[model samples]
Target: MQNFSKALLSWFDVHGRHDLPWQQDKTPYRVWVSEIMLQQTQVQTVIPYYERFMTSFPTLQALAEADQESVLAHWAGLGYYARGRNLHKAAQTILQQHQGEFPSDFEAIVALPGIGRSTAGAILSIALQQRYPILDGNVKRVLSRYFAVEGWPGEKTVEAQLWSQAQMLTPLARFDDYTQAIMDLGATLCTRSKPRCDACPVAHGCAALAQGRVAEFPFSKPKKTLPVRRASFLMMLNQQRQLWLTRRPSPGIWGGLWSLPQFESREDLIAALNPSMQTTEDSPASLVKWEEFRHTFSHYHLQIEPHRLDRVQEAPAEWQGQWHDLDKAAQLGLPAPVKKLVEQLEKEDGQNG
Candidate 1:
């Protein structure tokens, strides 16, 4: 354990990110925020968002009291909106149940919304300097390669073995540095593709390296094909330059966020748009523009056909439609794809005008 710690620390001093904003004071709250944001998100992509999030909700109390819409607005561009929702909920719980303090107990932390065993462990080890094992993707790859672990790490049996190994190597002293070091190594050196084995400090000690199986140790699981789903987005506009928008339901994809009205098919959408008057009304419905875009989710793909209606009589009951100036509408906290669609419309309008 001592030797392993020494090797990792020595490597981290030269290669690890020592100046990350979250590492400045190393508080439990700061570490917790960064850890949660970095889940399945890249470092470069998370930096700006993390800074803005911290600035807005600097403390648990601020986040707890913040409106759900405001929180989602801050997190608009960042996909996986559920993370932000869970974060807000967890903040409220901490404030109400724990008196505005982050729970130090592992079980208590895990009980919070969106927190899991690995995330709880990370908050404890990095923020509190406690010796807790983290089983995040990078750490899993590092440990699996170091010990030549077999089977898919996602499997419970394989993950249990890795957890035990992680516990064994976690040094009581310098636990924080050790935790950061291993993660850095995996992220930078022992990457999923094209690992920098020549410069790795523990390359000689890696069982997978000795066996010429650096990539094989962290076994890969078969990829599942994402199912394709289709939907229509009603881009309702008036002469006032304001666009109609609606709030999505509180759960499922794009949960609790504002977006254009979505329907299962174009025919259903047309029916909703023209409920009373038949398609052959005296004044035909004016469609100023129309376009289509695709947004991909983890488990599925969404084919969105945007139908732009220049004029409309009334909006459907499911939609809380209101018109805001295009610029103001941008500030209404629409999801990234919806925002992109609006930007495209703005560009087209500019070109036409």
Candidate 2:
């Protein structure tokens, strides 16, 4: 175990990532946000978002004080929107509970919204140089093959084994770099597919490789069919070309973010809207149709039917949501599908004008 850490650290000295945006001036806030963003997202994808996010909210206090809309606006287009909302909630929690400090204690930090055990460990290790074992997806792949651990990492038994192994191999000294090293090794060499076994420093000790079963160690989650759902995104625009947007209710899909009004079906949306809201007396009676598309989630696919009201009459309060100038709507934190819908509408407006 000790030698394992030594070899990994040595390799990290020459090849580990050294220039990530958050890595420049390591702070718990930055590391915490980066860790959350990096979950299920590639490093390249996270870099720009991270830089833009830091520019907007540079400190824990800034994040804490930001309105949820503003916070989600900065995080728009980065999927797993809950991360942004949770980040904002956690910041405020830190202010109220930890006295505006990013909590260093493991349990305290993990208790924060969206911060799990591995995330807490990674933040404390990387930012505070605290000795804690982290078993993120990258580390899971590395450790699974190195020891040929058999069950799916999501299973409690397999997860416990991986945690124990991570803890054992984690050296007490320079644990920060050790944390980064293992993650780097997994990301760069012991990758999910087409691993660079030749570049792996720990290849000599990898049990799966020794058994010629490298691909079989990190057992994948048992496959289940993703359910498909359907919805209609109503793009209600008035004469002023202001598109109506709704703030999704908290704790729901795209929660706490603005989005086009969603209905179960096109018929349902039309039925709910006031007949007068369809079009103005002076305008044509017809509505405009836009592109229909699908947005896939991890467990479900939403088949969206987009519709636009060319000149909606004054909407009653029951219509809900507010209309925004086309340009201003772009700045709101919208679901990807809604954003795409908006962009499509904006493009048509530009061409028509």
For each candidate, the alpha-carbon lDDT, in order, equals 0.83, 0.87
Tens-place lDDT digits, model 1, residues 1-353: 66777888888988888898888998878898898888989888899999999999998898899999999998888888878878988898899999999999999999988899889988898889888989899999998999999888987899999999889888877778888888888889989999998999987788999999887869876476466788998787655667778878778678877899888767557657756422235456765436677899877889888888764545555557566676677777788889987887777777877
Q: lDDT per residue, candidate 2, 127-210, as tens digits?
A: 999999999999999999999999889888999999999999989899779988888888888888999999888888889999
Best by lDDT: 2
Provide the clashing-pair count of each candidate structure. 0, 0
Lowest summed-lDDT stretch of 10 residues in model 1? 274-283
In candidate 1, clashing pairs total 0
TM-scores, all candidates, are: 0.64, 0.65
